[model samples]
Target: MNIDEKRFTASTEIQKPVPTKRGKSTTTWFALYGFLFISLALFVYVTNVLLGPLRLLLFDPPLFLRINELAIWYSGIPLVIGTALISWDLFRNVTRIRDAKFVRNDPPANRFLTVALTAYNDERSIGGAVKDFRAHPLVKRVIVISNNSRDRTMEIAEQAGAIVFNETRQGYGACVHRALREALKFEDTELTLLCEGDLTFRAADIEKFLAYIPHADVVNGSRIVEQLQERDTQLSLYMHYGNLFAGKVLEMKHLGAVSLTDVGTTYKLCRNVTLRELMPLLDPRINLEFNAYFLDTALSAGVRIIECPVAFYPRVGTSKGGNVNNRIATRLGLRMLWGIFVDWKGFFHD
Candidate 1:
């Protein structure tokens, strides 16, 4: 189908109203109260750990004692308020189905999908990654978007038969945004598979994504499965639990809408039409915390998302993303929380 025809069909399908009896007020109140309590607990714990030593060393005894006493007493006020609000919401609200879009048996018209891989200084793995996806029977084409890589990533990707483009804006979000935009230009494929060129994820998972895509607009790959993850991969035990915690926070924000377990995953499949509708709502400036931001924005916009477990392997090259170290991962996790609680636009540095 032509782009205009596809646009019309997508718009028509999206405009169809799904009936739901759930009230928005209750969900919003529940999320707000839960977040307030969790944020207060985290804030208290983090401050005490980070500032307790400094307060003892710098402040006089009287001042430190007063501050400690006040923190101890005043913190309970929010705790009580949050508990009451949540309790009220739970007792007042009745559980109802939020989504009427039941299990969809409607598969894509075309089985072939356009594969887009994000590359940044991945010369060691770009070629192999491109070839692996290109060899997939269902993959119509492979496209690679290099994020200003100073290496031969672009050259190797082209040599491996992938259509290559460079995203001058240097960030994972920018590269992923460019890939989706480019993938949408293809009329032969109805689906777009977004992944990284670091070889951590393989083309073999495309079947898993395809199986789940028929049920939702997007199929996000989850690396939380212990059997699927390789023992020597970059996903340490700390990062694994951290991703799960962040994913739960996001799930709570969109209560009863979606269940998420891995927000840090980069491998996902999106329908071209869904991407066309969702592109404008995404912000590429969110940096390392972009995946969570993407999922959050998609859920908030009423886009359906489902998770599929995919295998995780060791990286062939150096890791430049958030998984590089525990310190960077912690920073990224906090940034994700900040975006989730406050605002995403506040995360833009430039």
Candidate 2:
């Protein structure tokens, strides 16, 4: 087989499994969301119950207590365990930030980073996205993967000085996998910046990424900063908290030593060596939650990851990814967690 054929075969050999009949149940989805809502509410209520004494000391005591003593004993215990986990994460990040040993200088202008962006029906924004990255002094070339976009995305990207490629496979995971593969092929590329072909993220943040990339194999962007996010962005209040909650779960699972506040961001910088070593082990069939899967696999391979706070703007076009709606994001988040826990071995094997 030719190189292209071999690449195609490697990507498809571990394709995502076909869904069973039970997977089509709408009732089960409702139950899952219901369960999540109640669990979150109970945790919040119990945490508040634990703070009752301190709360009363700071504010006026309420005539009627809303929390029951039973919940304080039942849920509060689990809350304590959860708090311990978060505390440990906080301690680690605090030490890393405060210690001069962890401080890293930004990459010099000569340290060029190749940019790769994934596009799917983003004709309206791909050109601007490409141009933004190309304008960056540290960016050598901008590469865009138009994942079967029927629009003018390819034309616009090429017009904006990007090397455009078509990815026939139709998943966010597949598109990203293709982008990474193509990025590593460039001999000049030392680091690759991967992002979406939408205007949600800007090129100005590339400097921030370079500063953090020296300390980590992968520097991931975090949109959790309230001040940096534009109004009415794709990250709604529900989606924002949900993403953070999922990030916390992931941190607890594979990366307890590091505190990760955002695992869903597509904009990240990865060393060429890290991608060369990491991509072959990734299963593109993992679908919309590929970022989490990548992080899990990278951590397993001992890749250091750090988050950089980046500004988030409202997209010029509609979102086509899992963040299109809260329901879609929730489903994707569940799939991510399921993959992390139950289907751990499945990602490596078929």
**Cα-based RMSD of the predictions, in order?**
8.1, 13.8
The C-alpha stretches of model 1 lying farther than 4 A from their native spots are 1-29, 42-80, 88-101
The C-alpha lDDT values of all candidates are: 0.84, 0.76
TM-score of each: 0.82, 0.73
For candidate 1, the lDDT comes to 0.84
* lDDT value, residue 31 of candidate 1: 59
Superposition-based RMSD of candidate 1 using all C-alpha atoms, in angstroms: 8.1
Question: Candidate 1, residue 64: CA error in Å?
Answer: 10
Model 2 alpha-carbon miss at residue 300, Å: 1.5
Give candidate 2 regions above 4 Å deviation.
1-110, 344-350
Candidate 2 structure quality by residue, lDDT tens digits, 276-317: 989888977777888888887776665667889999999988
Error of 2 at 106 (Å): 10
Candidate 2, residue 74: CA error in Å? 4.3
